[model samples]
Target: MTNSPVASPAQTAHSTGSICEFQPVIDELRRALNSTLKGKSEAVELVIACLLARGHLLLEDLPGLGKTTLAKALAMSVGGRFARVQCTPDLLPTDVTGFSIFNQKTREFEFIEGPVFSEVLLADEINRATPRTQSSLFEAMAERQVTIDKMTHRLTPSFFVIATQNPVDSHGAYPLPEAQLDRFAMKLTFGYPDRASELEMLAENIGAADRDRSPLPAILTPNSLQHLQDHVAGVHIQESVLRYLVDLGTATRHHRDVTLGLSPRGLLTWQRVAQARAHLRGRDFVTPDDIQDVAAPVLQVRLSGDFESPQTIIETVLNDVEVPVCS
Candidate 1:
């Protein structure tokens, strides 16, 4: 994956004082999603934060968990072009990144864009695809560009992928390698809804032929979202907080239960996610709590350990690390 010249988000944000101006837009986007994805406030907020952070997501859960609905609602709320790719064992790399087609009359090869070209792409049952097919997303996810036949095609600036996998069925699934896993900023699971929410869903469905078929209002355009991402880059981080973050990363590396530790890329993404979370809460600077709040989702995707689950390991790291004093 080759990187092309684009305006640096950090530089653009620094040119302005801070990202406080975009708070209203962020809040509105959150509310729009919240209204549709009921009873999953935390999941919705994290999904929004992941977008603002300019990182991909991995959703691991059972079927009928509304993962697809969440992805659709997000795309609708942002007013971005949405595409879905149903991963299968026979899916080819060319099918995902696109291939050049021969034009008979013109005697020229034309490029056909794949689903990945869209602003929002949902890779459903990603693990069901073969490893060869799965590797197709690495470049697109990391550099936002895909090289086909030595020609590189750039994806939209706001391109985001939400890949989902069924946790229960691993028989025919290919486990995502560490490299592929590292590309995702966070991995989350949306569990079953609470009794009250389920009851509401049932009651509403009983009266109507189709339940909750209302369309989600588009609150932000692609350009507006990119601007918000740039603004999020301006959120502040104190020196003490930086050191504290480093300490947590280093601790993950040396933890007894872990086979693999958080990579530098993971650490950087973790910081960006924390900043985004702070921005969502209407703050310009990140706090230790902000980092803590996002640790489980961020670290769970990257950390591999033998002693306990990733979430438990992350929580232990949080408890052991001293929170930096912020003025």
Candidate 2:
């Protein structure tokens, strides 16, 4: 967590896992997530990468897309306690980070835990929450700890937040402050499904309207998942590829449209995310392509600029940088 991701993930990483040992679980996770959100294999790949990378994700899209479903599926696949919070204008800070209440019988104040205690948390319509309430998650997401009433509470080391928000241009939506956005590693969208995937979904739902489908069995225990994360953190990156990542980061900082460019911390997050992408592609070494593939979404959420479309800035930066050749 010291902004040097090459040495470790967000936390200390150690594993007794080999690639062969992880294949089955990774495939199971892929199937479960892919089925839950159909016709989004590309997005599914990114979601898995984010999980293995041990990073939070921000999902921005229109309503009724599979944002909620995808969040649920990811939690279920990871085999963890999942909590959902429906953000609203009136949500209080204590409502998210929990509050202290007196136990009448013992006469001692009890600290009630909130959604941040869960391994996977879904913040639905996050922009609807007031700034103070949203700020409740900042410490938890970044440092894996929450301070309440001058006492610090530690969350699960594997804690991951998947926050979804409607487009900023939508009515009643509040733009997230840059500090909040920087906490997330990637921002993605689950766009509308293709025709075939939609038809299959409708067919499957026809007879199951009132039935609650059993979730997929846990493909990985916490230990196993930790091992996969360790593996991703250990994925090798060539010196030239590291330089390439730095070059891309510099481009963002120097861009004319960028008001607040990618910070050093964001650059470290980018390094970890790119490592996850390489692991997902079954590679032990990072490549220039891995960095470029994740550039758009990883940069989109954190970069503050005057540009209307974040994608345009990503394209321009990617175009401006020269790809480094690995020796």
Candidate 3:
């Protein structure tokens, strides 16, 4: 709310169409994703919104719920390299961020790039990794760079992480520290699909792609996707909406049940994802609806409460604040 003068929603006309020009690519990405995962359109939309916002996703779900499939589809659709790490208790920090190895021929310790170097990194069962290993990603996720042996390495500009955790297994898993939780933009769950969707999944076979004559194509390059993210960043939000956002954030902080509320960083992420939601709706300007629509997912990653579920506490926080009426 303090960074720049908030523009009128009506002034957003100039911000339109940049994202629309890439509609064909977005549509194809959606289609390819649906073919891979049936009856999860809502989850797919949230994933796209998170992608355009350039934020990390934390997926908490049971095994075999298609979390990895979704991540792979997204990575392929963008035509970026996909890397997966099945995190375990013994997974080392060097394993995630890479380490220096002495090369006799080069006569130097050359850094070996790890899974973090890829554009799309799937840290499957991330909670299973030790905290020391998990902390290695904090810098890369936050700064987009890693420092090893006094040298810094920059990650791909379009780097996106989809980290998953299994809630059922607690014996060897370490609960993600709050600091790690705050780094992700959203924590989503891929619940089992409905009965009809289950039947559809039963009938899906990638080998049958030839029958449909449609295969997944690289819908957009990493650079092009970065441009689209810039367009999403430009979507305008009125001053009134900023105040509404601030109010909601404060309400969460003051909520008796919540021990840790949304931070300044989290609030900024909230604004960004709102911009993305508006862009996803084909609008150049953000409305109050955009803020509320993404509130739950955004809040789920940041807010911590003692008694109630995040959804219940989030509903309370939302009800406590008044949504702005935009012209």
Choose the strongest candidate by lDDT: 1
lDDT of 3 by residue, 1-327 (tens): 123332422122233355555455556667888877788888888888899899999999999989888888888888788999999989988898999999999898888999999888999988889988888887888888888988999998889999999888888888898878988999899798899989876676545664674545677777777877888898999999999999999999999988999999999999999998888777889998899999999999888879657999888888879877898
Order of models, best TM-score first: 2, 1, 3
Number of colliding residue pairs in each model: 0, 0, 0
Task: Give residue 273's error in model 2 in angstroms.
Answer: 0.7
Instruction: For candidate 1, give the lDDT of residue 109.
Output: 96
Off by over 4 Å in 3: 1-17, 206-215
1 or 2, greater by lDDT: 1
User: lDDT of candidate 1?
Assistant: 0.85
Tens digits of per-residue lDDT for model 1, 1-327: 114332433223233444544545566677877666678889988998999999999999998888877788889877788899999998999888999999999999999998899889999999999998888887899999999989999999999999999988899899999878999999998898888888887876785764447877777778777877887887899999999999999999999989999999999999999999998887889999999999999998898868657877888888898987889
Pairwise lDDT winner, candidates 2 and 3: 3
Clashing pairs in 3: none
The 10-residue segment of model 1 with minimum total lDDT is 1-10
